[model samples]
Target: MRLRRDHLIDLRPLTTSPAFARMWVGSTLAGLGGQLTIVAIMLHMYDLTASTFAVAMIAVAGLVPMIVAGLYGGMLADAFDRRRVALVAASITFASTAVLMILTWSGGETVAWLYAIAVVNSAANSVVMAARQAIVPRLIPRELLPAASALGGITMGIMVSVGPAAAGLLVAFTGYGWTYTIDLVLMSALFLGLWSLPSIRPEGAVVRPGLRSLADGWRFIRGAKNTRLQFILDIVAMTFGQPTALFPAIGAVLLGGGAITTGLLTAAIAVGAFFSSLFSGPIARYPLHGRGIERAIIAYGISIALFGAVLLAATFGLLAPDRIGEDSANIGLIALAAVALAGSGAADNVSSIYRNTMVQAAVPDAIRGRLQGLFIVVVAGGPRLGALYAGTLATVTALWFPPLLGGFVIVGLVALLVRLAPAFRAYDAARPTP
Candidate 1:
């Protein structure tokens, strides 16, 4: 019984903080809706363009706006009430999604409209995410930060897993209109969560959102070696390791089963995250968060490399069907690839738990929003860069080559970066320092 208890996720944060619980529930539901829209958009673009590069460009298009919003949103979070900032951002997201739904229903959604709306959605979401993340440390106790982060993993797991799969099925059967409509309905939950929260102004010297504020945040980060190192490590891992941009093509040509395959491949990562968070009790007890982050990311790189190997095997006619297309699939290879992706997801979640806890515990409240904003940029921007990298490389080379080569690049780069930053590897959770 004790062993079982030790291995289970802690529930105290939810039971102890009703406000956090309400917010978590709202975020989870709203996140599921967000995923629906994201996957739907990808599928919509692919159907219209039939170009993998075009599909990848969706994320790329939003990169600049998302970065700007994240940084400025962080400053807003610091200067204004976090709850209000989040609410305003959520409102923007809701309105944009409504526009998407209306356009799809009216048969007026061109590729250009889709791209523009996606940029708006992504930009607004960055602000919402920056504010929401900054709010977590204030709501929960310091000791429960890891558990809270694990719970966040669970939210992500459900959102990505169920949302993608559902979006695919909806787009396949009900068409894009229904998918967008469902997302529109789910976005309402975010308002509930944000509206229920009390006003949470920054606890320290607040910095207004602008050039001077960004400079101050940058100065703080420059002095905070451990925090800075974690950002670099995350960038390295994400830049080389992300292969999501290739999923659409992989499903169509390499793996088969079409939209279903894409959805399954994407959802597999969340499946791993969900289970990892479900059994995260032991993870919270580990003191060396720095070491944990390093080891987990290394494992993530290995898993991604293995996924590449699975794709490579498919190319060699290993466990492959004679004719692969939307109607048929290489189940064996798909399963292997899903397992590899799931492993990567689990490892990434573990790294996130440590990184989030470190940041929340180490950074002061006054600067926490700005720092988290920067973190959001790295978090969101890294994947955008990864999409461009994978998409361009795959366009020139082969589908399997990007993850295969990029995985090793991540492994080597992360190792070198960590070795040089002794302070990051030596970070102790008990005595948190930025």
Candidate 2:
């Protein structure tokens, strides 16, 4: 294969690895559909309960199960054929979503039923995510891991941006049934993606799936200082920094325009992620990845802080309703929110690119799947826990306080963590001695 320099980055996995490209296509489609159902379910529950706390609990309910599945699923990836493991996980995800859709379709949908099914879906998705992450490095070369990761971020942004906004429109226009059915159709594409990948099995001693395997993976993670520090830093950032749970309150109270504004703000973050990744050639050229992750997450903290500052401004009436995107959103505030979200997205994506590269390049292939499984767990579960935290805190206090305060916490915590662990800070991409 020929290498071409395009912009700041020189590698192009999309053109080189046909298998990776196919997987990306299939995953992207299914992800879009998944988002639609996720948004619809949250909205449906919110409408039924009229309680943001309840909406937050939907995430909370799924957290423990997801964590469990993620841990166990990593073992599965290490023990058996990864493709088969992924297919089984996907099957569970698909079946639960199908159940969710059918119940909503049958007109007997209850909040209790939605909660039950969402927990199942989220847990299964966690396993699929762990399996899929382990599968990606196998499909592409090491040199292109960052680009592949950036592309993954772009995929995430697009799926989240379009799906929820589309879900909102569909639910508002055609009811929840049609919106959910789209996910069912999209999910079928996932099977094709998994089926096409080469059969990937564990490289080293394949321990049977059990507590012993989980402990072995944890030990591996601990011994890898760079990997361990990065995980710790990321956890601190994600655990305290994520502001997604505040969207509903921001729409109704702080930002206005109800669900539409909420969707726009949510989509706005993805817009930032998508654009940032699009121009990621510069970021990919960075020599020091460990330092890059530290800085990017720090930048993310500032951006999220900006988001909170905007809300605080709105609360104090310093920023009027026009920008909030209500029946009368001040165009200036709308622009400001979008800017904040975009900046946050860019910083978060950069951090993700580096973190992903760190794990893929540093970890060995034998334990790689197991390690990646833990990575997936952190990636998927941290935000949900943050949601629970934000939601509970906001329920007790105020919406603006959560993000506003969370931002500062992320900034201080990440800086302290990075300073203490020089290994993560010293992670050089070119020398790459992870």
Find the candidate with the highest lDDT and give its number: 1
In the range 1-434, model 1's lDDT, one tens digit per residue, is 99999999998889988889999999999999999999889889999999889988999999999999999999999999999999999999999999999999999999999999999998999999889999998998999999999999999999989999898898888999999999988889888888999989999777778889999998999999999999998988888888988898898999898888888999999999998999999998898888899999999999999999999999888988889999989999999999999999999999999998988999999989998888898888998888899899999999999899988988888888889888888889899989
lDDT for position 131 in model 2: 82
| Tens digits of lDDT, candidate 2, 1-434 | 12223443334788888888888888999999998888788778877987888888888889889889988888888889999998999999888888887888899899999899889998888888878888888888888888988898888889878987888778877999998889999989999988898899878778998888888888887678888777777777777777776776676667676666667777788888887787788788776898999899999888888887887777777657445534655455656877898888888888899999888887877777778878877887788877887888888887777777878988998888889888777778776765
Off by over 4 Å in 1: none
Candidate 2: global Cα-lDDT? 0.81
Report the Cα lDDT for residue 261, model 2. Answer: 68
TM-score of each: 0.99, 0.94
